[model samples]
Target: MKNNIILSWIEEGVVSIPSFLFSEYKSIGLTDLECMLILQLHAFMEKGNSFPTLEELSNRMTLSLEQCSQTLGSLLTRGYLEILKGHTDQGIYFEKYSLQPLWKKLINHQLLVEKEQTEQQLKLEEGSLFTIFEQEFARPLSPMECETLAMWIDNDHHNPALIKAALQESVMSGKLNFRYIDRILFEWKKNGIQTVDQAKQQGKKFRSHQQKTKVEERKKGGTDTVPFYNWLES
Candidate 1:
């Protein structure tokens, strides 16, 4: 019966795994042997080897049976692997190894990596902003001015693109001052403008558009109004 099972697995063919498991994620935390053990466990599950033997696993690797046990023990202790009881389709309970802990660790590590990348990108953008401002103003920024520029991004949540647009507007208007650029940003904020393109389109609104309708009304004529009545005249 056992030989039949081994033959069945052989007939079932090779199991596929993501290359990243060994190429990238292995070096992050899992040791070489531990990574191999995980892959073997994965293969076992996929190939209907519900419970793979330590002897088989060790034979596949350079590790001895004792070393395999010790490694698995370490993995369990470190919360890298877990045992779970799950139901099959027929409602029969089966014990299986869970890789949930590994998945959770990988997810957290990726999130941290993404966050670090974003921070690095933001730093690069901030440096670029400093250089652009220096070139625009024809002088190095004062400490106080630099602090204000930092506040625009860090505290006010202004993205580099929006600030750059405002700078461009200042240059176009021949008023290359920080105050004018700040006011432009403030106006864009009030108008709920998210992109430079949106703000530019807003500047092209119809003269007879709703936004200008009130001013047009005033320019044309006033609405009808009753004459003021004196209280004592009645």
Candidate 2:
């Protein structure tokens, strides 16, 4: 009864993984068994085994039912496996397993790696723009805030000089948040205000108008005077 089942299956087929997965997934903290679990899920997909039960999975490997359940739970918790609901040919809905989360993660990790490589390439020539933000904001930047600043510099084509100018302008105007700084940048770009000198000249004009408005309100003896620093509109 213990005929050559192992030899027969070896003669039947084999599972293959992308060569890059070994290094990349491991670099991202997946252990050997975790990677094998992913590969086994792929094998189940290849066999059209929609929802491989714990017993079926346990039969394929040396793991017990509880071990298989725990491994699957770990994968789910780590966001590598997702369950999908589907309909059978007879119009019955059932749950199936998917490896889409892994693929999505691969794409994101690839982008993050590429970003790091680019930063390293430029490190010798340029200082970190993130440091400038942290200095101006007077606190350590969160990961999200660092990413946003990186996007502004790398993706939005914002040069550090202009960004620093925006920061200074925001501080001078008593508005220091990213939203106000972004609005200042947008207004400058819209009005063709390129240099700090141009921005200063524009500020002077705004102050002149504001003073004139205040003087007129005073002449009328109005209790409410015009805002002294209304350059934000300008």
Candidate 3:
């Protein structure tokens, strides 16, 4: 008998609510009561009751029928709920509730929030990149230099880490200047080196070739030497 009762309860089914609605309702300008009312409507609709009466809705909650009607009116006014009217085969008119507006609002709000977070993160990264550039140069950047850096990121679409790698390469080669760093960046792009590891590998290969050339020159009794890997020349 208990198993039969449990099976009957299970047959009654459950209401499906979007998990995000619980967390993000307030962000989309819905109060607790309004959100709860929406949940009740959703439950009723899921049970094949498209338009549950205010009395039926309020019977399951602390609200009175009048309060439920007011809340429904407010939801319609605020574009969170919509009543769709249609006719049946016998030309009978019927009204049903649609939660589409609410779903759309929730999705749009989430997208806007994600966009804001991405912009904030990008701003923080840009600020740190600028500070690192100033420290490396040992001076505050001029307006033109600042513009150039912005151009590298915004227009040229260079990654901050890649730009920093180019700067380091310039410093190591004893050519600590913007023009030299630009040339390094250009050569790196030309060679399809998007990562610092790839840049390091390219430098190692060049140094190995230079070492082989030096050994051959020594055998030929020539004593000329190249001190640094000049990216501009490459």
Name the top lDDT candidate.
3
RMSD of each: 9.8, 14.0, 4.6
Which candidate model has the greater TM-score, 2 or 3? Answer: 3
lDDT of 3 by residue, 1-234 (tens): 999999999999888899999999999999999999999999999999999998899999999989999999999999999999999999999999999999999999999999999888877877788899899999999999999899889998777878888888778788888888888888888889998799888778876787788889999999966746877787
Per-candidate TM-scores read: 0.74, 0.49, 0.72
User: What do the candidate models score in CA lDDT, each in turn?
Assistant: 0.77, 0.76, 0.90
- The TM-score between candidate 2 and the true structure equals 0.49
Report how far residue 145 has shifted in candidate 2, in Å: 31
**Tens-digit lDDT string for candidate 1 (8-113):** 9898899788665666666468877788898888888887775677897888888899998899889888999888888899999887777778878887877888
Candidate 2 lDDT by residue in tens digits, 1-234: 346987788776876667667778877668788888788888888777867888988888888889999999998898988999878899998999988888778778889999999877565223555677788888998887777677766787665667777777777777778877777777777888877788777667765777788888889996654443433555
Better of 1 and 2 by lDDT: 1
Q: Candidate 3: list runs displaced more than 4 Å.
A: 1-5, 88-92, 138-144, 151-162, 165-175, 183-234
Show where candidate 2 strays beyond 4 Å.
1-11, 14-16, 125-234
- Count of residue pairs whose backbone atoms collide, per candidate: 0, 0, 0
Worst 10 residues of 1 by lDDT: 225-234
